[model samples]
Target: MKREILTLAFARAVSVEFIATLIFVFIGLGSALKWPSALPSILQISLAFGLAIGTMVQAFGHISGAHINPAVTIAFFVGNQISFLRTLFYVVAQLVGAIAGAGILYGVTPANTRGNLAINALNNNTSPGQALVVEMILTFQLAICIFASTDNRRSGGVGSPALSIGLSVALGHLIGIYFTGCSMNPARSFGPAVVMRRFSPAHWV
Candidate 1:
């Protein structure tokens, strides 16, 4: 375990997780902010998040597998695709990166536009149980897509895994935004909540 962790490639992968997550959170929340010029639409926010994840995946997938979300990382581990230590380190890195990204956005954004930093919460009177199920189904689809697209054991072409994964995220948001603000990834929600210093009960769900 020690030898594995000490390897240069392992260190590089961990670092990439942090950097990729930081960028993902920064752009995703930045796009959702309430600008003085105009309020961002749901389609805009969904596409922004999708584009951010897709771009990061394309850029860093080769380096670290680019699991920007903790849920995806955990899912990979649960599926026996990665070791426990790797999953643990990746989760920590992603969380730290998310907080750092949200912090930086908080610093750069105008105060009036911050508006909770796009923190996920229960919307449309969604019950915690209902939101929980919604989140599970949405995350399940994304995780399955990630696993299917990136599985090296596959022989045939997958046709742009990054785009597939990204569109999956956007597709989730299209329905999820009306429910729990679309928290398919725990890190995505946790980061902004920590930065904003507030979290609702549904956040736990």
Candidate 2:
């Protein structure tokens, strides 16, 4: 009976993660799609991702801790917040969810407007090394924010955890977008690349 209960809990957690990640990728990338008359501004795109993540967290945090990103799941594992098997399940769910979300976006939008489902790439002449540094820094900041906001022992002084995390994501995108299209989550980058079949060596970085 105990084993059955644990299995059910694990299944529920995986399902929640998958659903949250699907929502995150779908809404976030959909906001960046090039419409006929208007292109999304950096602010708009940033908010899309930020808000999506924040909303997903709020919606599913109780169920699965809303770990929609593979990086976040790995961080939780490294911090001993989750077991290795659970971490693996969460990461797999997130990746699958991301791909499903991107795939749905691809199916709905016109072919011409579906620009690789907003795959992350270095803008301008930014070198691979520079892009890597920027991504690392942005992800590190995000990870720290996650740890702080979600720490139940920490005293709260401001808004909800969702809002704080959302704002951080937006801020990161505002800065990192110009350099590397702001991909702090590997799953976010992987989904579109897989759906569009547009893998570049830089994407692996």
Candidate 3:
């Protein structure tokens, strides 16, 4: 791909990223708080997240490749699927999209239900190293799935890319939720952190 500062493709990609992320956060966070009672089952929460991602990707995939996660974007860049300049633009767009998503979630939700906007972190006894390892493992699988599902050469096209992507997200949440609330997407964590004013070094990790 040719390197350009800002092109129509980049803009569309960024806009799609922002809107998709906003929907992801709004639905995911909304479920975490509003439906906490009914959504006590981890499976329920996982499905909620998964379904949100699936829906967003279906809605926005054609517009921006449906990259709602920064980690996936980084890995794709590392995998040489995207150009450097494009990577920079995508990352910035993802971050801004994340913040916008979080902001909208904060505004729409009730004050009592905010709960720090569901910031992700280690549980009571998990170590920092363990958390990192877990995040890496989960994110690796996630990024790999993104690469595979989006790869025209590899995919059979039996399932929608949106469905596959959402399934991957839910898979991570199933295992990582107990570890670090399963923040496979840094933008997902960062957006809420910035909004709740609880941005921490750990979040950067």
Provide TM-scores for the models: 0.97, 0.95, 0.90
1-205 per-residue lDDT for model 2 (tens digits): 2353378777998999999998899999999898878999999999999999999989888889998999989999999998888888889999999999999999999988997789998887898899999999999999999999888787656458899899889999999989988999999998999998998879866
CA lDDT of every candidate: 0.91, 0.90, 0.80
lDDT of 3 by residue, 89-205 (tens): 777887887888889889987786778778887887988888999999988888878777778876355566788888988999999989888888888888888888896656755
Candidate with the greatest lDDT versus the true structure: 1
Evaluated against the true structure, the overall lDDT of model 3 is 0.80
Q: Give candidate 1 misplaced runs (Cα > 4 Å).
A: none
**Superior candidate under lDDT, 1 versus 2:** 1
Q: Report clash pairs, candidate 3.
A: none
**Winner on TM-score (2 vs 3):** 2
Report the Cα lDDT for residue 31, model 3.
Answer: 66
C-alpha lDDT of candidate 1 relative to the true structure: 0.91
- Higher-scoring candidate on TM-score, 1 or 2: 1
For model 1, residues 152-194, the per-residue Cα lDDT tens digits are 8898888899999999999998899899888788888989999
